[model samples]
Target: MSVIEEERVRGGVFKDINAEDEDQQPTVIESLCMTCYENGSTRLLLTKIPFFKEIIISSFTCPHCNWTNTEIQSAGRIQEQGVLYTLQVKTKEDMNREVVKSDSASTRIPQLDFEIPAFTQNGSLSTIEGLLDRAVAGLEQDQPIRKATDPVVAEKIEEFIQRLKKLKEVEKEFTLIIDDPSGNSFIENPFAPQKDMALTVAHYKRTPEHNAALGIEVEEEENDEKPGSDLDTMRNEVLVFNTNCPECNAPANTNMKLMILYVVNCEIWRSHRRAGNQNNLTDPSDMSRDLLKSETCSVLIPELEFELGMAALGGKFTTLEGLLKDIKDLIVSKNPFMCGDSSTADRAEKLELFGQKIDKIIAGEMDVHIILDDPAGNSYLQNVYAPDPDPEMKIEKYTRTFEQNEDLGLNDMKTEGYAEK
Candidate 1:
């Protein structure tokens, strides 16, 4: 009879490990929004794409009514380690006056509800399978049970199998369900959630008695600031306009209306519309009309508003022609362009170059539009050359030949022959 030695695995069995010890907690993901205001209403829109394992938080504050709101959304997954979540909230209020109806004044207000969705990620079964393989190996190596007669070995095997089954069931793949606050479910991609999920299971080699002796505490740091503060800083850094008071000749409050108009024209409108050349007019006539149209443009100061009329042909025009005049006027008014003031002179000189370019466009020498807006809302300048028309003019001449007979009407006595002489 051949005697075979039973190989003993040194590592601990499945019963020795704890599943909770191997599990990892979920993490929060953040998403931020880009915001803007137009008319009397504010708009907040998402700027970046959200992914699994991250969260997004966006907030907006209305300058007109002092109303504020915030939105948050989550990004899912980090590794096979943690899940992600997100939240968003919004608030709005009306800022209008009351209207008189018959004998009473009634106020109308609007209400708005702001809500965003929640995101999640669940881990895969492969992770559990890995844990099970390790646990099973440990169990088989810890005890050598070749015979069913051994009660002690039989009991250990049974227990190992039971734990393995439990782990297998728990480790099956799970899906994350995302929904808005209103209970509406969001669609998952490819017939499933787009986010990747994973689970981290903790394995403790020691007994529960020994594991209880350890203590763990995790603290996360906080670093969030008010949303509108940055915007406020940007607003403050922008330049504002000031002019002398016509009445007292003293420096008056900065013209807020004009400043706002400047800001809108220089910053917002130009930026949005991609207006190319700042100095070039698409249609000189229309340009003049726009300059004088009070309704077309509005200047808003804190408490005052300026309704400027359109630009006229002669009155301090700032159109291309006006700009040229302004440049000349500035040179004369300051007398610095001709002197040793090289910087002032340089600006004035550039204005002349610009004026020449504009003249060429107007003279039909250039084929391209003199002014255009870039995608970034900055003006662009371009020059195009076109051929002149034909010089010689064509003319046509006509001559007529007629035949006539000389004869008297009622009393024609002698017939006269009037031949061509």
Candidate 2:
């Protein structure tokens, strides 16, 4: 071959080898700055930050922009390429070597011990058959043949005897006695005599002194009248009265007065039933009509006296006559038939009857005073009575006014009165 041709061929072969080497080598390029264009072709010396332990460029220089900064761009661990050849050589050395030891400890087997009780060598079935044969022979013989006892049987009997001895050693005896106030007595002996015996007996008896300080006298029972005995039979009977208001023409408040009468009867019955036999009556019929009159008179006279004073104080009426006139007029207007019915008359009679019965029950023993706010004033009229007054009377009045406003409309003019008493 010509020299020039050989040189050209060698040059081509060298060019092919250089190309293969370039492909096999890892690619390394300059990391670019995203914000600005800069030919930073220098290799970045990356390392981890000291305390923050993040990725850092240990050193770098921008070739074109000439920008030099040591501060870390990305805050993370810097993972570099590992030494592959060194790792392969170390692994191969570990595989080729074999571990050796000069001395070793000897191993020994562990020993254990257990205990088993000795047993007889006799076969279980043969032993049972021999016992049965002996028993059968003894039963068939006319003579009383003694049967030999097995060692096991003897041992069991001996154990039972030992158990009995132990029980006897621990056993104890006790006795108890109880005596009652009514000449009654109880006695107990936990361990009783097992067999009868002949014995001599002696008794030494001593009488205890009757001490006055230790004795207590028992109380005797007494008979006393029970409560409500006088009025209990009068449950069905009540006296009612009917009247009218003359001025306002409203109901005369006779029912209201009757309610007051009931209250008075309840109070009297509760207070005086246990007082004496003077109030008691055997015949209810005999006391019926008379009882009605007295009770009404007693409650009405006092209640009217109270009403007179209350009326005068409240400026409602000047006298009892005027008050009665007004009440009659009111009743005539509000309850025209209040006094027209048999039921009304019956209720009036009942009220009178209850009053009379209460009067008899009280028997003038206790003064039946009508409690009044003013003892001296004789007013003819009083405010309406309510048993229990509402605590939220004011709040209810306000709520009712609002409800009226809502119903009547804001522009509508209307007068709202107090809620019905």
Query: Top model by TM-score, which number?
Result: 1
Give the Cα error of residue 100 in candidate 2, in Å. 99
| 140: Cα error in model 1, Å | 88
Q: Candidate 2 at residue 201, lDDT?
A: 13
- For model 1 the TM-score comes to 0.17
lDDT of 2 at 102: 8
Mark the regions of model 1 whose C-alpha exceeds 4 Å error after superposition.
1-250, 255-320, 327-335, 340-369, 372-421
lDDT of prediction 2? 0.25
List residue ranges in candidate 2 displaced over 4 A.
1-315, 324-345, 350-421
Q: Report the lDDT tens digits of candidate 2 across residue range 1-421.
A: 5563354334321121122243323224577754367656444332221211222233446766677533223322211110000111112112221111001101111111111111111111111123223223333343222224355555554454444333223232211111112111111111111110211111111112211111333355543536577444444556456543322222344432212122122333321211000121222222221111110011122422222111211234232233233333322222212232212464345334434434443343323222222211121122112355422111111112343233223224322332334
Report the Cα lDDT for residue 407, model 2. Answer: 27
TM-score of each: 0.17, 0.12
lDDT string for model 1 (1-421, tens) is: 1121111011111111122333322223332323334223323222111111123333455455565444433322112111121211111100010100110111111111111111221111112233244336545654555344587776767675665545345443322212222111112111010111221111112223322322222344543535675544654464556553321223345533212322233333222232222232344442222121111121111111111111111122133334334333432333222223122454446545544544554444533322221222222122221143212211112221121011101122222332334
lDDT of 1 at 5: 10
